[model samples]
Target: MSTSAQGPTSDESLTPVRWGVLGASNFALTVSLPGMKRGPLTQLAALASRDIGKARDAARSLGIPKAYGSYDELLDDPEIDAVYNPLPNHLHVTWTARAARAGKHVLCEKPIALSAKDAEALVDVQRETGKLIAEAFMIRNHPQWQQARDWVRGGQIGDLVSVQAAFSYFNRDATNIRNKKEVGGGALYDIGCYAVNTSRFLFGREPVRAIALVERDPEFGTDRVTSGLVDYGGAHLTFTCSTQAVAYQRVNALGTRGRLEIEIPFNAPADRPCKVFLDDGSTLNCSSARVTSFPTVDQYHLQSEAFSRAIRTGSPVENSIEVAVDNMRVIDALFRSVESGRWERL
Candidate 1:
């Protein structure tokens, strides 16, 4: 496996982290493999799918060295240093544990598990296996989000009071894993996790309580539309996510004296530079806005680099299992709030 051109390609002594992907899912094939290939620390090593032909085709497309007809085969390979688990939400914890027990570091996609309780099991898995396991929240590593947080902490937005975000996309296909109720399909789990995760990121604390209104799809039996308010006691984070609406995403942090906005918060494009706006409370229409644009970056590439670096150095992963479990607690509370019709205390 050769190093990619995106990072410090001049470092000849650095041994690349051998990575194996759990499944040949679309996100893994298109987004993850290509993105990781762009980073020098990663070596596109092995890919696995239930079908050998599909796995081989995917491997050939991305130039990954090995293809396995079963996930266990790739996990059993000693050369693979880490595993990227882009499996469905329900399978996240199961496969993540398997990879860890196989003595491989794992990066599992979010929402990390079906429930907070289910996600908590990985805490024991990591400690017992002595292997690092992390949740894949690529946005946390993005420059735009980091800058936004830095500005907030620096008082650029004085006394951050509230965060507002919305993420939605129309997908009602019953066959899609995202719409399948049995497999943990819903707005809250799919897209709303970003809203919940980002709000907590800016707040620098877990929400104290949560209240929500969730509307389920009649046919899919999944939460199609969910609006939740997470109270951090003094500050609040509010967001709405929908699986049956037009595709859109935006995040704004409003402080006592000013506001900051992320134009394309979630799903920021890799080809173009992204922008964030800062405004004094002099106007509401963003007329008094000061704009800052970030250079072109693939957050996924940065994410892969960070994960592999952690594995190589024996350091902590960026989003540890503990962090993922805390996020899950917030999501669980919001769901409880939907049922109780009252604020659920976290």
Candidate 2:
């Protein structure tokens, strides 16, 4: 709760921001943790989990200097300037609020809350503490997405007409957290959020209404597949996501004069180059499409660096709590539409 508008320390202005992880989730281990270690703007200071042994083992294996038995201990560490919350969807808001109250900036995992109302509560916490809290939407930091957004905004794709996207992965494990409804598990809450977020990001606005159809798994009580549509005035966004299908993802944007396609839309590879395909209406064959390949870049590193810069300079982040809330509002409407069998206004 140190709400003082103090600037970064003189040394910290030249050094990396000391960062801690709230949990030893696989994503933190494989993606965010490595990103922190590699990024010049962040220091992998510590890690904490409910199980002390696991925390210690992970810290040792990851070369982190400190390990805590509890998340509170990590948050209370005066040396840690920020904490990454890779907890479950339901725990995102709680731990993020705690981190902010402990005078630490937060880069929380996506779908920052299960609902719009909960997202609003987190926004309130940010307002009260004046801390730099951002939902960890790493796609926003990817060069592919940045270029796509720029092209769309720069009128390279002409007037936007529609967006079509799909994301799926086969995960049949009954005990997986994504299969548990109580923890905010579902196809929509998992991969579908990315599709929705991408649409909103490229469109640069929220939908006016939404409709969705979902099929749930009987044993897991989680949506196995879902298809949704969002009305954005003259333009529309359509997406389908599934947990029971083959792993695949693609996003295409259609406009009056041309189209934009992302070959590796959501799960971008960090070690290999990724391409964005653009096609002007002048050509009739697939060979007419132009390809732009981005070099090997770790988006998680970019995200961490962006958050660190915001904390160091008191600047705004790309994925603000308000953006999360708006995304959740569209998600809430989609769920309502699925239940009511009609379009739900946002």
Candidate 3:
């Protein structure tokens, strides 16, 4: 596919950044697409899929005005200012590179690549293209995570001690993409990424070492369950994630003087208030813990707006490719630990 640059428009400052969806993934349809439509600085311009019929149907159903039979066609559309890539893990790097070279900013799905080396390649592409490219980490855009980070940094949690988190869901469908080995399928690449990313985000530092244990499904050749520990020198993080278990998630940060607990940490509710519980360690009773509730907000919308504003104003994107590379390094170390049955230094 030939790459082309998008020309500047006279109304660029006044018009919203037109966005195209690279695929009709469920998450794209249910979350990102709706969020882009609601974003103040973004417009849902087009939808694309390998199948023209599917793209047209999705576009009509979602109220988007245009549809393309292939991702390359969508990338070539000069009217589109950016693209949201909800493609599978393996395709993230390739399509993002294509979109960047085509002069389109990219907001790609999480675990931007299967390995740190692969993530670094995307970082190089971002630098060479000089385009706004970021990993779609919506939690960082949520007020709840920002508040939690503030509390931790402001000494409300005192000297950081440890972080514990768990994310799980039951999905035994062998035919699902998540169950396929060649496409970067596994609990670690899927929901486990949140746990890893959150640990780094809250700690504000990379881990020095990591150890992990993973259990693979014999038929699927993908990890069904995984547990890992990351040693961050002064503090450590422990987390467990499973794809074949009941749906649930929670994150807790413990310090010498206090503790912070996040309910529904990873998959936060957009329609209702989400809460963070804090215990100052001064009290011996559970009732002394302070509860803070955040108003209902769509994090995906916030993410889209932030990206669009960055593209328009030349501001910094929140989840940059560099940060994604760091997260992937930890994930790579964890996988190495799993294979060697020993601690892997990052």
Q: Which stretches of candidate 3 lie over 4 Å from their true place?
A: 1-14, 282-285
Question: Candidate 1 residues 122-152, lDDT tens each?
Answer: 9999999999889999998887888888888
Error of 3 at 223 (Å): 0.8
Q: lDDT (CA) for every model shown?
A: 0.89, 0.88, 0.88
Name the regions of candidate 2 deviating beyond 4 angstroms.
1-13
lDDT of 3 at 34: 77
lDDT of 2 by residue, 139-231 (tens): 888888988998999999899899999999999898788999999999999989998899999999888999999999999989999999999
Evaluated with TM-score, which candidate comes out highest?
A: 1
Ranking by TM-score: 1, 2, 3
| lDDT (Cα, tens digit) per residue for candidate 3, span 224-276 | 99999999997999999999999999999999889999998987877888888
